[model samples]
Structures are given as C-alpha cells and as structure tokens.
Target: MPLRFPIRPEGLTSGPTLRPSGGPNGAPTYEMWKRRIGASLARRDEWKESVIRFFVELRGERVITWGAEEMQQYFDFWVNILYSNAKILLGHIYFQDPKLIVKKTTDRVIELAPMIEALAQYYQRELKIKRTNQKALINGIITNLGVTKTGYKAIFGEPIEAVDERDEDSIAVTERSLRQMGLLKDEKKGVLDPEKYHELIADERPFVINVSPFDMLFPVGSKEMDELQWVGQEITTFLSTVKNNPLYPKELTENLQGTHIVEMPEGRRMLGIDRDAFAGDEEYKIIRIYEIYDMKNNQFHIIEPTVRDFLHSSANPYEVLDGHPYDFFQPCISPGKDVYGTPLPKIDEAVRLEYVTIRQRIMAHIDKFVARLAVRSDGLDEATLRQAKQGDLGSIIITTDDPNKVFSGMPNPGIDPATFIHLNQLLNDLRISTGISEAKRSGEGRRKTKGEAVLIEKGSDVALSVDQDKVDDFVTGQARRLVQVILRFVDYPIALMFADPGQAEQERAVIPSEDIRAEVHFSVKVGSSQQPNPELDRILKTDLFSLAINPATREALGFQGKAPDYVRMFEDVVAAHNLPNPEDYLVDLPPPEQELEEGEEGGQEPANILQALAGGQQ
Candidate 1:
C-alpha cells in the first residue's frame, strides 16, 4: 500500500501484465511473472542512492514560503550525505521580492531581522540581510505571525501580559531600515532626521587606513594656514569629482619659488611700494606671518602651471617620473594644502620605502595615545565615562539622538511645564529684588522685621543722574526676603549698610573622561610591490582576529589603510515621533503605513473601474 509517484498506471494491477496474456491485447501468465519481479525489487539500490531533497526555513515554526521548509531540509540532508557539515557553512543572500513593493519589502525585512539572526546563529556562523531580504522576512513574518500567534502566546504566557507592542508602532521605521539596506532613494532630505533614526543595522569584513610613511614627509607647523586651508577646500571639491579620491599631493616642493599671496595692508613695511606688492624686508619684527606648507622630500614634479613649466615638456611623466606611478605619487595619507605654488620634486623608490617606515612610527604612537584615554586598571569593571561639567563649559557629547526623547533632554522650548514655570517665577523675583524695596507698598509682600535693611523709594539723585528711586525700590524689595541682622560698627557706616555676600563659584578646565578611544593601525609599504607587506598582512590575518579587544579598542583601532566615508557616532542614536527635526513637540501618532485602498488606482479608491467591469460582464 506504499505510495510511489513515478509508477505507470497499468503496472499497478493485481498482477502486473507482461503483455495481457490470454486477453485480446496479450499473454497474462508471463506478464504477471515479469511484473511481480519488477514490483518485488521495491526500489533498486541505485535508485535509492539518488535521493530527492527538501528545505525548510521556519519562522517560529510557521513556513514563510509554503513547502520551502521541507524542500530545504531535504536538500540539506542530501547535501550532507555528499559532503559533511554543508548546512553549517551556508549563507543566504536576499533580493527584493518580484511581487512586493519596495516600501513593503523594507518594512518586512527589518521586522524579521531578529528572527533571522537567531536562525543564522543556529544553522551557520554568519548572518546577512539585503534590502531584498526585507520582502522575504516580511512574508515570513506574515505567515508565521498569523498561524503561530496563539501558540506563541501560550508558550510565552501568563506574567508577560503587560508588555507593550513596540513593533506595531513607529511605522516610519520601515523607511529608515530600507535606507540602511541601501534601497531607499528619497534624495530630498539628509538621513539623520530622528523619525528616520528609529531603525538601522549591518555586517562586515576588512580594515585599512591612509596614514602614509615618513619618507614622504611633510613639515609640521603650529599656526593654521589661510591659503592652504582654501586650497584644501578646492582640492576636496576636486576629489569629490573623482569617485574614490585617489591622490595625496602634499605641499612638497624641493626647490621653492613663492610669490606672496596678497592680504590687505601688508604688515612688512615698504616706504612706498605699490598696493599689491611688497619689496624685501626689515621683516625680522615677528609679524606672525609664516609659510605653512612644504613637500615630502622628493614627491612633486614642479612644472609650470602650464605645460611649459615641465623640465622636459615632451617627456612622459613616468619616464621622467623618477619612480613607478604608484610610488612617485602615493595617495596622500594626511590631508594638506600646497603652501608654495612652485613645482615639486619627483620622488624615487628608495624614498617611498623610507616614507612608509617612518609614517608607521607616527601611527604607532597614536595607538598608544588612544589607549591612554580608555579607563582600565586593576580588576574593576570598566564604567561609562561620566564626564563632569566644568566652568562655563557644559558636558554634552555630539549625537544624532533625539533630545526630546532623552531622559535629560533639554527642556522643551515650545511648552513650559510646571517646574520650569515655577523656576522662572523665582528667578524673576530674584532679578527685581536686589536689596531693599519700600516702594512695593501694595504688592503681595510688603512687611519685614524691625531692623531689616530696606531700600526706600527715593527720587533720582541730582547731578549724578542716578535712578536712586528705582535702586531704592529694588533694595527695599530684597530686604523683605532677607533676615534682619546687626553688623559691628565700621569707620564710615552709612546707617545699617548690608555687606555679607554669597560664596564665590569654583572654576576648572574641561579635560573630560571619554568612553571612546582614538585609535590607529599601522600600514607599511615594502618598496613598491603590489603584494601586501608581509608584516602588515600578518597583523591583519592573525592579530586583528585573534585579539580579544573591548569595544573601545575596536573603535580605536578601526583601520590604518583607509578612513571612513560615514562614521556613525555612538552619540547619534536617536528617535522621534515625527519625520524631520520637529519644530514643535512630538505627538505619538500612528505610524506611516499603506492601508487597504478599497479597489484603488495610484493608492486611491477605484470604484468606477469596478462598476464598469461589472456592467461589461452583465
């Protein structure tokens, strides 16, 4: 009675026919014998060897794609037979579902990320989710959330009833998550808006930075450069045009010729030089002027701003370039501006290697500097850096987080809560009541104890033009708030003068305790080879992975070969009830979701079309 799909209809007979023996069509006895032999094999060993496979991806044990779970499981089992541990190493790549809208796809994936994360951990060591993954996750959640809703509740029941529904609220989280997945194309606004900040996440590989070596050295100066800064700004614009920004042109010129850039009223004195020009100098008077830029030893090929400036106009830059293109002009490790507009010296191979070596030393020290900031000593667990406020300086970390939502977010500029109103009332009273106020003879407070120092309302003092009356009013008002006290006589006591003052405020500098450490990783070049330097390569493969670094260490040693295009600051995590930095308060409204359109077109109701179709059918 066992069922098999591939069997022919005629062969399922009581006794299979070899050729219908004795019937109009064939010989029954021989047919029966051969059919019995065929059926008796059950299945050939070779047939059993080739097994069919099925896989299952369950969301809380509810199948997202119907029958996919069984297929996945079967495939995993068969694959294992051919190769051991195949399931444990598999990774999945999700794409946008052909049937789902881009918005819906994003919403679904974010919802399912936690679920997918658990599954990835169970089946494989790695996990990933593409924008496309959203659709699949959404579909899975829809399928799972529906069927297992009751079961999941029962399993996680009783004392958990008070939990709030975080997932259902904040529908804008879908759009934010989509953007993180690299799918949303809304170009009008920057992505940092807090309503858009509620959702985000990722996975990664590799580490590198642009800190170049010492041979391609640039001189350091304390003063900030004006022209250099401007040139840097222009160069940054130029680099933006070059997709990945590939050059590092330091302001290096071997033999320099600099024409002074004009600034108004030249500090160096010239008896009668033209407005735009200055002749020589008594220049040793220290006018704070400086040449803030210089080139790496042999890095530039100083040529005319035009083609005529080259040493040999017709020669190739490579043949005339001293070293290979990559080394002659290695990408700049540190950002700089050309201090002198003159042609730079061409660098050779020897210099490039040395440059890499010394730059590595500078980078190494930076690592030590960052380590100094992280608080680690003895066996005490590391605590969050609780920075203390100092002087007029406040302790606030720059963040993208929504302030209104924060526990200590600044008081709302829009609404005055009761505490703030009460504080404001107290402050106004202090501002008006200075010393004594007898003028306030009919207000809420007017009485004072017998020897209380009170400033009475007196008319303006002549000649001096001082508002003695107003001053008296303020002073007398203040006396009502103060306790009456007698002071020992002074040489020139102007009848009951008040003198005790409040304590002076202490002051301090800001050196705050930072939870995050600045870090640097060393990168060295072995001459000009395409191969990774053996020392650096070894560090990446061995040191980076094996080292059990804390979060601060990971942040510090982010990369040495490259810098980040977008650095997500730890302080930037935030959320809001509405899109954009709300000009007013955030009202907790329902999230943005697409609702059922009731037979719509372009998301509007489509009643006419339905009516027309019905009429046509009739």
Candidate 2:
C-alpha cells in the first residue's frame, strides 16, 4: 500500500497540501504529485548508480542502489584508478589557476579573485570550524568532473538591512550598555546584560558555506521548458543537540499538522520524543533534516519528519551558485543522450576494464607452475607408498634404495616476458585513451627540446580542452549566479579584502551588493597567468627584436624616428609577453655622450640606437 500523509485540517488544503485533500474532481492528489517526482528521481538515480558502480566510488551508503553485484569488488581498485586521473584533470584544467575577473564597461573593475578567496576562507572558517577548503574543493571538483554532477550553494546570514534594525528590547539594552560604559553618567545606573552585549558585538557579516555533492540531489532529467526558476533539489543534513535538547529549536520538536513524516506519516509525531531512540547515556541523537526544493515555486520545504512542528523554513535563504544547480560539470561528454553529462570515469570505463582483465590474466599465470611425482612401489610397504602419496612429513623413506624413481621435478611452463609487454601496452592505452598519457609519461620519454616539449604539452591539453571549456562555462555561470545572489540578498556594503595589485600590502574595497545603479558583472578566467604560453612569448620577442634590429623594416613599418619610440615599441613586446615592467630590464644608455653634450634636439636624434648599430655594421 502507498504511504499515507498525516491527518490535516481542511483549511490547510487551500495552499499546497501534504495529502490528497478535497480538490477539483480531476485534480491529481498530493501523493500522486510526489510519486511523479519520486519516479523521475528514481529513474535518474538508477543512471547515477550505474555510473557510480562502474566508475565513481563514494563512501558510506551510496545515493543510488547498486545495479550489479560483481562490480562491488572492483570499487577499491577502480577508485584508485579513477582518482589518479580525476585528480590530475580537475587540478590541471581549473584549479591549477583560478582567476575571477569582474567587468564594468568592458574593463576589469577590481580583483574579483581576492573576494572569492576571502569568501572561500569565510566558508571554511564558519562551516568547518577549521580550515579544509582545499580538501572540500578538491572533492567537489572531482565529483563534478568525474562523477554525476556538482553544485555549490551559498548560505548567507540575514541581509544588513534586516539585521541592523533594533527593536524595543535592543534599544533598552543599548541604553543600559551606554550607562555601564560610563558614557551616560547622569542616566539611571544599570548593569549591562552579557547576552545582549555579546549579541550586539558579534560579527554579523554575510558569509558562505560550501555544500558537498554527496549531500545534495536535484532533477538531473529536467527539461528546458519546465521554466523552473528555482532548483528542485533535496539536501539531507544533521541537526544535533543534547539530551531533551534545550539547545535544539523548540519549533523543531513541536509536531506540525501538515508535514511529511520520514517520507510517510506513520512515524512518531514529536521530533524530540522520536530522537529518544538515538539517545544513549548522555549523548543526544542528531536529527536528520531534509531540505526538499519545490520546483514549481522556487523554495525549500524543511522537513523534520519526527518533529511535531515539522516546519523548519518554507523558503530557503541559500541559493545555488550555478544557474542550473542540478547539472554537473562534465569534462568528456559521451556520444549517448546527454541527460546527465557522462562522467570522465564512465568515458574511460572500457580502458579501465581492459586493465583489470590484463591484471587478472597475469596473476593466473601462477597456476601454470606444475609438479610431477613418479613412484615405483614394487617392494615398497603400504605405509611408505601412502606417505609418498600424501606428500606430507619432511622425509619420506623409499622402501627400495632407488629414490630417483619416486621423486622427480615436473616440467613447468615459466612466465613469458611478453605478458609484461602486454601489460605495459594496456596501461599505455588506458592513459592515452583518457588523454593523460603524455602528461603522466613526461619523465619517462626521451628528453625533448623546450619548444618540442611545449608543443607536446599543448597538443595533450587539446584532448582535455573540450572538457576544460565545459568546466569553464560552468564556473563562469557560477560566478554570475553568485553575484546575482549577493546583489539580491545583501543590503550592506561588504569590504572585499584583497592583496594589493601593485604592492605587498593588503587592501580593501567596499561593494554594495544591493545597489540598483551597479552595472558590474564577473567572469572566471582560468589558466591565463597560471599556464603561460612561453612559446608564444618567445616568438613575439624574437619577431620584435628582429624588427628593432632591421632599420629598413622599421622605416617600412612607419617607425617614429626616435630611440625612445623604439623603447616604447619594445615595451609593447614585453607587455604582450606578459612580463612586468620592461623598464627594469631594458635600460636606455646615455645618448653616446656626444649627443648628450649636443643636447639631442637635432643630429637625427643621436642616430637612434638601432640605426647607429646598423650604420656601424655597414
């Protein structure tokens, strides 16, 4: 029988209902609506499990049920295999050098990366209580690129406008604090309340919390026409408190009338009482809170099934950083239906399978080593024959004097070296097929010239560039979405602390996220300064130097007849080469001393440096 919803008042059925309350004759029941969503999620989760089974190995209970039993044994080995490339690909493509560029009027407004860095630090500081941002980001990126999908939800406190407003209680406390601090000497004497003091003095700046992929689920099979303005995701998390939990929210334990209970309404109503099941001597059981996203209307229903007042938050404050929070960053999209972009591990599954097969074959070679024994028991006692046949006891004495007839070495087929060659070939194919063969084998190959090596590396990245571009698009979208959230939610001016672009000291710039006049936007630029094109720089430098040395080419190119102009031209070359300050390296020599004495006004501008050099050569 289908699980039923709890009894609720008829009045509660006017809005969205938890049960199939009275409605139009043809209206689908609440249970039916849930089933539709559940069915789609179940179908999508099957695909997720298939990918996870073959490639992705997650800790704890998997989100989806395993399809095949045989693959479970391979999880450990495949995790190792999958992680090696996943780590490299995620690192090389995006995190190797992540740059955030904010634009205003087609010009970079300020250093956006520092703001992101600060946000990342804030996330670590607030949520983790200790620093583990890198670990968190690494896991998130790997899951995004190699598993099913990835999402980042930014959790913010109440907007400044909301938090700054003080009620009558706050005003009275502030007045008391003023008197306690001796600022109001003539006012009525009163002691300051510690709770109020702490509340008033606490930092209330907006911050972020990073959500792991494993903790979240969204509509992977959603269509474009769904017009889903908000995410329809389900996030599961813990709400821990002490025994009888005075610290836990009272609203959490008080049973609410119209809420889904542990997915069904049959469970206990009181959350606190239900949690007694997890209660031990003194430890409190953590209550599981399910934050389900309602698709039609962009909001979350915070459901704590056991709680009497199951309502946590009808509307979620946090928003997904990427527009399509459900879709994942897929590096290598397979040829099949792109409902969910195929994970990198799935794309390389065939190669990985071959690798395992070869490994098993090599291990099976041990079975070929066989031994043979021939016994001539013409006069041997039954005990001796039995002992020889048993192959037990250290020494078996032959009844007859001829022992060579009883014991002999058997013909053994030794392992072939060709098997090792085949193993190596398989590994090579695995690496090449996945597009990391050159990068992984950089140390093993014959030494290549710098140019050749660069070309090789560039070519190797070509295979990954497609996936890299996809990641870039996702990241860019995330940046844009984050900005939108900040603008819509944050009313206070935020001080973005950043490293000074010109100096070593730290600097700060304030951004007002709620400003209507603000026309700022941002895009994430990855692998620009981090992965420099040295070959391009070298070529440009050589070409410019060649142009500088040849006076004929300079004249034909409409050269401004001055050495200082040539200096400016060289500066352009250096700038294009992405070097900082050409003046530091390229010092201008005093104009031949004679030109300095003659005051460099006439005399053909002291023959220009290149012209003088060319004249001497002539």
Candidate 3:
C-alpha cells in the first residue's frame, strides 16, 4: 500500500477531522483522500477490476485478506518496506535544519572559537607569572636573584654583590643566550660555517627538507623517565636479534662476495643500482630445468622426472619501472641501426652505471645467500632447475569479490572487435619481420631435409615448396616424414562442445517458473568470402596432408597447425638468424602422437590426442 501523507492545517489549531469544514476539497481535504483509499480497499471483494486499478493488490500487496498465512506475508512485506523508509525519514531529521538555525551557527565562527581560546591561554601563561610576588615568596626573590648572579658571574667574573654593580647589563644579550649559543645555530645559521653551511632547512632553519610522512624524530631521554612510578611504565627488556640492525649484514661483509658502485657519482645521483629495487624487476627471467652432467661421459643427461618452467610477465616488458614505461620510438631489435633515428649509447650510460654497481653489490653478498640456498649450478639436476624456473605465482587471493557487483557505465558493444584484430595484425607483422622462408627446389636428385620431400607445380600461387632439389636431399625426406607425423594427429572438431563455465546463471529472487539453460540445438553454415586455391587443395588431398599440431608450438612456429613440423623448424631457424644468441632459449620440440595399446578398452577417438594432452608430452 502507498504511504498516505496526512494533511496539516496551517497556523497550528491542530484539530483537522476526516470530514472537517472549509477544506481545500468540498468533501473535506482528508475525507476525499480517505475515500480514494477506501475504493482501493473495496476492490478486493470485486472480480472485474482492471490490472492498473488493482496495481497495489497485484504488483505489491493488499491487506484485505484475514487468513493467517496472508496476514503474516502482508506484515512481513510492510515491515521490509518500512525498515528502508524509516532510515530515509531519520536522515532528513538529522541532516535538515531551519534557515534561522543555519544562519545562527556558522562553521566560520564555530571553528575560530577554540583557536581564540588557545591564544588567550598562551598569553595568560606567559605574562601573568612574573616577578610580582616579592613579599617573601621563595621563587620570586631567591631563585630569581640566584640565576641572575650565576649569569653575571659567568660573564663578568664577579659575584652578585661585586664591583660591577653600576655596569650597564643588557637584558637583550642575556635573553638571547639561546640564540647566542651553538644550540640555536641550526635555526639561525652562520655559527658553524659561514660559506658552506647547509641552506637546506625547514623554513631556512638548516634541517632536512620534505621528510617522509612516516619519519619521526625523538630525543634520547635520560634515566629520569624510568624513575617515574607510573602504572604502565614500559620496561626496556627489548633486544635486537639481527646482527646488522641498521648498517651492514654479515652476508654483505667484505669477506663474503661484496659489491660496490662502479663509479662514484652516477653523474647526477649519489647512489648506484639499488639491489632492493633490482630484486623486484619483473623482467629478470630464469629458465628452469633439471639436468646432471657426467664428468666421465661429458654429457648432460636430464633427470628422469624433469620439467621446464618458462617464466613470463603478464605485464608488458617496460612496465618493470613504476610509471616509467620503456619507449621504442622506432621498433627494431637490430644492434647497430640508427636505433630508430634516436642516438643511443652502446647501452643507456645511466643504466650501465647502475647495473655495474648492482652487480658489484650482488657479488659482495652472493657467497652467504648462495651458501644458504643449497643451489649447485655445476651439479644442478634437471628437476631442481625446473622447479626454480617456474615463476612462483601463488593461487589468486581475491577475498572480497562481490558476486553481484554490476558496472552500469559500459558503452554499447562494450569491448570493440577492432582491438582483437589490431593485436592479431601486430603478431603477424613481427612474424614476417624476423624472417620468411621459401623452399628452393629444381627437378630431381636434390640435396634436402627428409621432411621437405613434397613436390608440386612450380610458380603456383597456392602450392608450397618442401625443399631445394639443388642441395642436400634431406629436406624433402624430412618434410615427408614430418607430413606423416602430422597426418596421425589431425583433429576434427569434437562432436561435443566443452561446457563454458562462464555461462553459470545468476540466482533469481523469485522461484523460477522456467528453465533458461535448456539446450536449444541449432546448426549454421560457415562460408568464407574467398575461394580455396586449387593447387593447395590438390596438395591437401595427399595422404600426408592431415595437420595435427600442438597449439603452443603452432603460435611459436607461426602456423595454424597446417605447416608440417619440418617446415616450421626451417622457418624458426631462418627467423632467428639475426638474433645474437639464437640457440640459448629455443622452443621445445614435441614428439609426434603415438597409437594407443592393443587391448586398452574404452579408448575413444582422439585417444592419442587426449593422451598426448594428459599422459604427458615426450
């Protein structure tokens, strides 16, 4: 039911009845509104009332029913509504005030009152207690003259009653003793060094500027504070367990591996590469794999249970320095080019100095830290390396996520498809930039790789050359072998679609009368605007043309799982030709899928594929 507002009579006689005389409405102001409510109340007995007229009954609730269940539900509904409404009513009472109240109690006057009181108290304390109580007051005559006599003795070498009784003693010099002494030199300056004293200060007082908000300074007090017999007097029982509590750790001692700044002044800065910050650098990547070398055989045999962890930052490379992203004006990894027209030193000179200093420091502390870590690089097993290589990304720790949080400000078609297309274009550009390979082959009896054995019509736009017929014949043979391996793992789309967990439905408030997740199966035809190339089509018809490729290698190999592994190997080699050290970190080569055992039951199609995914890669 809608909350009906009662009519208030002006000028406060305060006795308006349901049928009062001389009202805004002829039937009486309250009476007419009550009648409208009565009509809504009477509609419960009728059957032909329109949905609009019976909205309060149908959409909300009507309290006409007297049954126990109906009565409870109505009461609950009203209570729920009033609980929200009561807060809003109280909010107005707390926040609102009459114009007279606002004008009388202004914030400007209220805020000034305490400050005025403080200033008055300060003046009273400074002026009221002076040398006025001279009628045998111990402090007024005794201590005052004693302090004066001591000061006179200190300056003139004479007692209080000595011959300097007529000498004009300036109160300015005596009162300015704090400023005259070295104690106040920091506030006034020139008492220490007239030329080189630090001008830096808080308001020219020669102090450190712009200190950290967290930094606090306190004077070391005497044992007097300990003498106080307060109830909660803290005992000084604390002891520091860390050896290098402030200055140096045993790990960074000279006997250990110690680091130093390669240079004194880093040109503009005093310090060098900050080791603490360097440890946080996201780009510091490590390859982890376990292998043990045999001194006799001179070969590294990977430990039985071995794995490789490739660490990468989800963040961009240059984002390691907070707020300072590295900019590549003209993107080229080439060593000696114009560097995209910007003249760069052999390395950034600033960074070089910093890095050198960092290396020094790390070496200084290396012996102790490395000694404790139990890491033996010479004896590093594949398993240990692999474990170390994996970036330690802990499980996601989102504690206070709101399941029902909604952002209403997103624009239509919220995320544009152009972004995805742009990203794809960028990857493709870098794909071609490094290197593109084209096989060269003539007639017959050519030297080539084994996998590159395939031959097709020359100069055909769609046909791909497997290898050169001119050189080593290993290319063609390798290409053919690679084709056979791919043919075995060629995957057709699974008949069943993997469920999308993101499609979990929300909880509806009302008991759902219908199921929305019921599958409505449908089929659609996909058509490409361009037609297939005839020569390529013919090539695909061969028994060797089925493409089964691992998804990860396909990305690194720049193929849509179509190109054979032998072809990809050639491409990778050609692309990485310009790299300074190409063999250091190459992508792992996955073995071809093998057939399942003879009597393993419940073996589904793509069992080799599924097993290749799960039974683990060779």
Candidate 4:
C-alpha cells in the first residue's frame, strides 16, 4: 500500500494534525514542508534499515546473538567473500584510463569535437571522477544502490578591489568576472593576471557528491528516478559551517539554535559517545539539514527541522537540460515494479548466518570429542591419572604389574564425512549465487593451453557484462549532465592543456564559451578502461605477427606489393604490451620519392619488405 499523508485546508489550525496547513495568506511554511518530509522518511524506514544492516554485515559485526552457554565464534564470510568480489569488480572497471567519446550532433558543430573532448577529459581529472566512480561502485555492490549528485558549484571570496561605477574607461571587473576567476584574494592591489588568478583557486570546480543510500528518500510508488515527484537528502553538518555560508540569509542563520542530540531522520543512532564531549562547544555543535528537490513544484529548499525554519528556499537554480542532477547505479534491477523494491545485495545476512551456524556447530561437535584416556580406578592413583591426562612426551606413570590391564586409549569418534560434504556444497552454492566462480576469484583453472585461458577469461567477462553495462550507463548519464553544466556556466575563455598528435610536448589552447556551445552526444567506451588480459594480448599479438609474415595474406588484404603500415602496427604492439605514449617511441619517416620514368635520373629501387622488417641495410 502507498504511504499517504492527509491534505488540509490552507489555513493555520490550532489543534494537532497529521498534515501541515499553510501559514497566513496560504504561503507554505517551513513546518508544513517538514511534515511532508517526515512522512516521506517514515515511508522509507524499512528499506533504510535494511541498508544499515547490510553495512553492518559488510563490517563483520555480530548480527546473530547467542546464549551465554553457546559458543560465539563468527566466521566472517560476508567481508571475506563480498569485499573481495567488490574489489575484483573495481579492478576490472577502472584499471585502464577512461575514454570519453564526444561527438557533434550536427555538421555545423563538427569542429567542436576536439574541444569538447578535451574539456570532458579536463573535468574527468579535475573532479577526480575515477575515484568517485570507484567509491560509488563499491557502495552499490555492498548496499544494492548507489547515487551521485552532479552540479556546478561556484565559491566566491571577498572582493579584492572595488572599482568605481562611474569609471567607464577603466577595466571594470563585474561580479560575473570575479566568479569566473574564483579569486580568493589579491596578492597585489589593482593587478589581475589570469594565470595567477587561476592558480589561486585551482581546487574550486564542479562537484560530484556521493550520496549514501541511508540519506536518500523518494516516494513509495515511483518506479524510476525521473518519475519521482520529489527527493530529499538528510545531511549532517556543523553549526559553524552553516552560519559561515554565504548562500543562507543572515536572518535565518543568526536565529538558529544548535543542538548536540539532533535525531537523524535516516535512522542513524549515535552510540557509546559521551554527551559531555559537546557540553560547551557551540561552535562545533552538530546539526541536521534537510535538502529537498521538488520537481513537481520546481523548487529547492534547505530546512532546519529542529528549529522549524527554512534556511534557503528558491526556484531550482540548475539548468537541467538533460535531466535532474542525480544519477543512480544499481547492479541489477529489482524484481518488483516500485522504486522501493528490494535489490539483492552482494551478500545478505541470511546466507552469512547460515554459514556461521553450520561452521560453529561443527566446531562444537569437535570440541565434545577431544582425545581422552581410559584408565581403570585400580590401575592408577589420582596423581597418576592426572599425569596420564597431561599426555607428556617423556613422563613415567606408576602402574601395577599388569600394565596392559591398567590403561587403554579411548576410541576416536570420527566426524561424519557428510558434514564436510555439506559445507563444501554450501560454499559452492554461494559462489554460484554471486556469479563469482572459484577460478575467477583464485585464477586457478585446469587449462593446458593459452587458448583455453583466453576462452575462460572471455566467459568471465561475459558473465560480468550485465553489471558492467549498468555502471557504464550510469557514468554516461553523469557525463551528459556534466556537459550541460559546462556549457551553461563556462562563460570565460579558459586555458586547456592537452597533448597534440605528433608532438613531443603538451600544448595549451584557450576555449571560449562560444566554442563549447554545441549539441554533443556523450558515450563511454565500455571495456576500454578495463585491465588488459595477458592471454587476450598474446592472442592478438599472434594474429598481428602472422599477418606480417604471410605475403599471400597481405596481398589478399590489399597490401599488394607494398610494406604494410608499420607505424600503426607499432602502436598496436605498444598498446598490447600496456605501454603508455606510443607516439614518443615513433620516428617520422619521409614519404617515398615518386617512382621515376625509365629515362629519369633520380630513381631508386623500393626497399625489400623483409629487410625493412629486420631493420637491415640493403
């Protein structure tokens, strides 16, 4: 059933109510919005609790309790298997450099492809996107859902020099220019060097914030991200940071009250911390801020629910031409039709509980059957029995004349082999359920040839392709949103540094806002950034060498009587070997002189293909 809140008339009421009525004149008050947010959070409590429990399992916490008399040893299969699998996926997903393919949608903007690609690559490095991607993927794998919020953020510092408004001839710096420069302070008064300004605040750029699943809230009936009417995030921050921020009005910040025990709506509880630690520390008092993105009303708001006040409220400030600034990643789709459907975590609590139960029982059984000595009461005294129980290597035991009648070793209570068989089957079931095979994890397979290894690797890749494709789609969506932000806000001609083809050193070019104005499509070259498979590289090298040696094959492939393109072949070989910058190792050769007629004077025979291949003098 859908969780719904009651709708009240637009007027202040005196009695307690489930829903909030607006203030005077029908303007929505902060309290009104707070009720709405509270309802949304209450609806998502179950899923949020599950996410927290999954995190506990990932950390190998004690989820299953035991009695005082029971053995309490936990074998952490959750972290042992799930974390290792997550790392394996991360290695394959981000080992190679990502290649962002930007193409012009129309012929008129065809020249902008290189500039767009360079800008995208610059953002990729400046934003540390690969790190963000790794973090998000790991979170998604562990918790079933990962989210990222992308938008342009500009931070402004105090003005260096205020120019007179009447000075038209003077180089008057506008607010926009100051924001573009992102200047912190003026080292020298009245001097503005673009290079120095850029160096001053190089860290200020667009942001991609990773939002945890616990802090996110959406409606119960929405099936997809875009279909949601609103989304809210519960943020925990210090009181001083909120007061110092420029976006919030001073009226709201000054009147705010700080509290040390603010209840987080995300079901997060603070435990084992002394409240006296924050007794007199008002500057660092922790607080909760609720940020809501209301798509239905096209409004954005930041509220302090503890004090029942709105910090900042305005129309949506972002130019969401592609979509909202949020991107979601799920390893696999949920089985139900609603957004609240439960996604399968990499490892759940039930499986871990079952494994631990069986293993602990086996250990307890073994404990009951430890080696013992069967000595007759008449055969030995108490002291002798104690000595025998010690089972010392070189100790004498006083006994009667008939030593054989005195003592006998207890028969061994051998464990049932089926117990081990059951354990093995459980492990096998786990591997199959997670789709992480033993060979894939341990890299141990009974293969006699490199070809078989390559085939196995290929099969593993195919098995993981479904999850990989989902991550790729999420990344592509983020790239599109990032491009939109760049086009809208990058109004100044910023200097971009990139490597030019056939050049030994890097080059710099200034891209004006006009250059970035183009309709471009964004895509990620899937698997291009993945780690190189050595077996696959060996196969590729074999094929390239065969093509180079077989003259008939070369002729049939239109190489005719000329040597193949050695430069391209060299680059491929370098890439196969996982070497960087193949261009640096290549030498430019002059074009072959046109063949002269029989009577012409300056004519030379073509170099032999074999001699060229061997780099030998003819």
Question: For each candidate, what is the lDDT?
Answer: 0.24, 0.45, 0.25, 0.60
Q: Distance from true position, residue 314, model 3, in Å?
A: 31
Where model 1 places Cα greater than 4 Å from the true spot, the runs are: 1-197, 201-618
Model 4: per-residue Cα lDDT over 1-618, one tens digit each: 121223334354221123323754344567778887787678667665665455455444344343322322332233344565676554454634467887657764566667777778778787888778776766677656678888766554644333432333223223333433233234463435433233212223678878766678775445656456567788888888888886666777876667765333332235544445445565657778988776545556888876646687655444244224677787756544456555555344466567767877776765675544443556776777677666542223333566665444433246687877888777666655665555665665335466776776776667677776787787877787777666655555555556454554334555556644436677777445434466566566657866876877677766455666767877787776678998989766545557678887862343787655444345
Q: Summarize candidate 1's per-residue lDDT along 1-618 as a digit string, tens digits.
A: 111112235535322212223522331233332332233223322222222211121221222343534553443232223121111111111212111111113444444333322322221112221232222222221111000000000011122121133343333443433333223434464533433333322222211111111111111211112211100000112211222211112232222233333343745345465564432222211111111111111122222121122211111111211111111111111222221111111112234334434445444554543222211222223233343111122322222245333223221222236644555454344323221222222221222321221222121012112222222222222111111100000011111112123423222211112211111111111121111223333333333333424455556657544333221221111111123443233333444446557776443333686544343222
| Model 2 error, position 551 (Å) | 12
What RMSD value applies to candidate 1? Answer: 47.5
Sorted by TM-score (best first), the order is 4, 2, 1, 3
Candidate 4: misplaced stretches above 4 Å? Answer: 1-29, 43-45, 55-81, 160-204, 261-280, 319-323, 336-343, 346-364, 370-426, 492-518, 526-618
Residue-pair clashes per candidate: 53, 8, 39, 0
Model 2 scores a TM of 0.51
lDDT by residue (tens digit), candidate 2, 1-618: 112233346565322233333324433334433544465457556755765654434322233343346455443334344354555554454353345565544223343444544553443334441222233334433443222222222222332223235565555543443332222223232322432332242322333234544444334333221233234344433333322333235655533223222331235444443443433422222344544544333334544445543243333333323323333344444533323445555555576667777676655654443333344556666886677656543223343466554443433246577877887887777677766645434433222355664565566567667656666665554444445444444444555545455754334555544343244454555543124555555665657776776868666666555442566777777776678988887855534433344545543443466767443222
**Residue pairs in candidate 2 whose N, alpha carbon or C atoms collide under 3 angstroms:** 254-308, 254-309, 255-308, 255-309, 256-308, 256-309, 271-306, 271-307
* Deviation from native of the Cα of residue 156 in model 2, angstroms: 12
What range of 10 consecutive residues in model 3 has the weakest lDDT sum?
144-153
Once model 3 is optimally superposed onto the true structure by TM-score, how far is the C-alpha of residue 83 displaced, in angstroms? 70
Q: After superposition, how far is residue 421 of candidate 4 from its true place, in Å?
A: 5.0
